[model samples]
Target: MKINKNIAISDSGFVFNPVNGESFSVNPIGAEIIDMMKTEKSYEEIHKTLISKYNADEATIEKDYFDFVGLLKQHNLIDNNEEA
Candidate 1:
């Protein structure tokens, strides 16, 4: 899936959605995920990166990744045209 093109993200984990004029903050991991999405990285690429950098196992990272994506959906932070 793709992140909304207008969203503004900061290195300090501040996220601003221009369409809705709403702001949010995320943890470091979440910020990393968003950054990857911003670059149009694929899900498998993100999963591999997270698994290598963090101590989490494959299954856990996969679950958490999808959960985070679901949150983005709930908030309309992602493009509706993309597949999840």
Candidate 2:
């Protein structure tokens, strides 16, 4: 999925959505996920990268990833026109 073009993110995990004037702070993993998404990384690529970098199992990662993406969708952080 792609982040909204108007959203701004920082290396320190701070995210700002200019469209809504909303800001958020994410955990390190979440930051990494957002960074990867900004690059238009596919789910498989993200899954493999997370699997190699983290100790979590595939099922756990899968669940968390989807949950996070859902949250992003709910918050309108992802571009609606983009395919996940």
Candidate 3:
């Protein structure tokens, strides 16, 4: 997914949404996930990358990835066209 134009995201996981006039922060894992989503990575790509780099399993990553994307949508951080 693509980060909204009104949002600013830092490498450190800080997110500021000008539209909502709010800011939020995430952990390193969340940040990396968002960054990958920004690149428009497919679900398979994200899953594969996580599988290779992290200790987590496919089922866990799959659930969390979808949930995270849902949260981004809820917050208007990403647009419909950008969804994986």
Query: Which number leads on lDDT?
Result: 1
Local lDDT at 8 for model 1:
94
Task: Please tell me which predicted candidate would have the highest TM-score against the true structure.
Answer: 1
Model 1: lDDT to the true structure: 0.92
RMSD of 1: 0.8
Cα error, residue 43 of model 1, in Å, equals: 0.4
How well does candidate 2 score on lDDT at residue 32?
Answer: 95
lDDT of each: 0.92, 0.90, 0.80
Lowest lDDT sum, 10 consecutive residues, model 3, at 1-10
User: Which of 1 and 2 is ahead in lDDT?
Assistant: 1
Summarize candidate 2's per-residue lDDT along 1-84 as a digit string, tens digits.
788877788989999999999999999999999989888789999999999999999999999999999889889999767666
What are the RMSD figures for all models against the true structure?
0.8, 1.2, 1.9
- Misplaced by over 4 Å in model 1 are none
For 49-77, candidate 3 gives per-residue lDDT tens digits of 99999998889889988888888887778
Poorest lDDT segment (10 consecutive residues) of candidate 2 = 75-84
Candidate 1's residue-wise lDDT over 38-76, tens digit each? 999999899989999999889999999999999998889
lDDT of 3 at 17: 84
